[model samples]
Target: TATGWAQGGIAAAIGADDAPSLHAADTEAAGAGLTDPAVALRVAAEGPRLIDWLVSLGAPFDRDADGALALGLEAAHGRRRIVRAGGDSTGGRVLETLVRAVFATPSIEVVTASVHDLLQDENGAAAGVVCERDGARFRIRARAVVLATGGVGALYASTTNPRGATGRGLALAARAGAVMRDLEFVQFHPTAIAVGADPMPLATEALRGEGARLVDETGAAVMAGIAGGDLAPRDVVARGIFQALARGRTVYLDTRGALGASMPTRFPTVAGLCATAGIDPARQAIPVRPAAHYHMGGIRVDGTCASSVPGLYANGEVASTGLHGANRLASNSLLEALAFSGFIADAFDAMPPAAVLPEIRTARASSDLPAIRAIMERHVGVVRDAAGLQIAVDGLSRLAETGCDAALTALMMAQAALGRCESRGGHWRSDHPHAAPARHTEATLRSPGAAPSEPARTDEALAR
Candidate 1:
């Protein structure tokens, strides 16, 4: 589910003690200097109303006894204004409510299947998706297709996303001639529990907000600016953890002094992980390391969540709405998804139904999936340089050389990542670590055997 691993609560300027401008400023700061100020301002301004709407929909946000909203502070926030539900289980709770609403509505159909490839009509516009369900292949045709398939955290050996977040939507859009952006900005959380889990449990930023400290094996503060440490933006914190690992220092998060008596009630998710790892948070420091968490870049979309392809829509982590910019603020992923889902739904509802979608069956067969996974994890995983990115591009191109449509998606990701020369947000590179003055570029070329040309990266093209 899209909401299972969300540990931090939603960031909003809903608290009386806070204002929207402060929130927007923090957002731009976290986005690594590439955040669109207009988008930041708009989302921040509308956050309170969105939160109220979610509350009305039975989101169960924690509220004070007097009926005021109970807010919690996370990293990068200038105030204690995060809206939470069931403590750290905000994502799960929100997902539960949304799933129920989706199931109850006759307008939405919940299908349990993985989309194998996109189906296109004679005119070359995306018409439907080829999905594999219950070991049988089928096609679901719609006038508009919205991809909320989530992120690529699973491609790494360690992640905090669902197993399906293998950049499936990213590849799908690229192969369909949709414009992609910011493919290089992959965010790595600095405080993932290093328990060797495939998707490591997250040590939420709330722990630091509650006064947790990052220390080494000797219980010494390894990070500078101790008082203002953990609240540093994700990039600084992730790089700090990387440095500690480079020096062979065992990194640990000291929550005993901060979480205190509220461990079980306030953050059940973190408590459960600690119990499973056999580490008592009240008594000992938890082992921690940085791991891939979210993708800042994705299939490019406009305000309406439509992609470059007509009738194709993308939402959630799959769509790059220019909101997160280079880096995403903590807990904003869920908010962005919720806000845009409506944008996509509304746009799709207003469009007419497709008269006759393509019925041509795909001839491609699945093979070497494991090899493709290995290649992505090896070169395109985390740190990247020009040579490594080029190698990844070549490798993905060869995958397309096999004539599999799925491989084209991977090739597009590699090609886009290779073209981005500067580091921004999650897209860090030793070769290009500084932001350069450059106009935004969209990767609109499709995978092999598809369309070709330099499609414009305009809002109109994204809305299709």
Candidate 2:
């Protein structure tokens, strides 16, 4: 789990009835970021089925007063597809339901361990995983390995992700030679409660969907002049907040007049979080700042959630299925995870019998995570320039001397971000602050004794 918890409220799962339009939103944001349009579209098209499957698994969903599906951001544009449970604790409720289902299944054995690396067979195919539990290392061999270790948010100082979300799956896959796509595109949530917490608490975008406005300390609307205002795409909203912060203005989510009396009922989770932080949404504006939230890029996978390496699979936030493109639509991640998990299961069932397991031995490398986090926060954050990116690349390269997987992952992202000269989606380059011809970045780990290389940017025309 990314947050060391079964559920994290990072994104909503359901979407509106117009799945094709949602697909277009994804394409517009991703803009040549996806590896395959067909695969991405299939995942989008499966949204309804995935929601139905979750409901069948005992997941409880909430309906609006109109008896319509309550919607989350982006999807909330003109349709209702966002559903919740226990007010704002939708992810928690869904996770609890799934955990119970897993517990009921006798064949499944849940192990508590932190995966450090992947094990490969003599033919270079994935065979198992290397994990550490309670300071003891062990190897778990399997016919098929799924990397769902989650995102790389912990690599940044100001992040809304759990401390455990340090890109372990990405590092393991890259080291094992899986091709990584879009590592440069990391999405920052626009409204993380600015209460000085290590893992910042989120102020869910659903609040804005329900009419809460973003404003500065002067009681001026921060998103006033923007076309969509508070209802803009996440990347746009996040940038708006980032710019406000840059200008020494304190940004806030003002729900007072909009959500006023209904704050606690409509957003119990956020209200609780606000209360803990000594703010009342009903009486005051909740202070907020942008925080590193989600990664739009990861270990690249195909339609079946299969990585480049046979016998290895990835799902959830760990796999860059391209459904999100450069910027992910709100709540689509959960849908993708559920939809692809089914696809992976079917693919696994059709696979040939596994060959004899191979004996493999590997040691986990330790990382100076705090140092890496500081470097990333300083150099590769929401906005980037050539000098800062170069500094980050150099700093991470030096840290790579420790043989740290986390450092390697950071280095990969910095390298890719540095190479892409144009500003697009979450990857904002102050130097090149305009969209260029759309392109996708692809990277592979270097072979021993070979010179390290930057990721290749595939032109949209050539990729298509």
In model 2, state the lDDT of residue 87: 62
User: Per-residue alpha-carbon lDDT of model 1 for 322-353, expressed as tens digits?
Assistant: 88887899888877877776666677657766
Identify the runs in model 2 with alpha carbons over 4 angstroms from their true place.
2-36, 65-69, 72-76, 353-360, 448-464
Question: Candidates' lDDT values, in order?
Answer: 0.75, 0.76
In model 2, the Cα lDDT at residue 22 comes to 57
**Candidate 2, residue 38: lDDT:** 71
Worst 10 residues of 2 by lDDT: 455-464
Q: RMSD of model 2, in Å?
A: 4.4
TM-score of every model versus the real structure: 0.90, 0.90
Those runs of model 1 whose alpha carbons end farther than 4 Å from true positions after fitting are 225-228, 258-261, 361-378, 403-411, 446-464
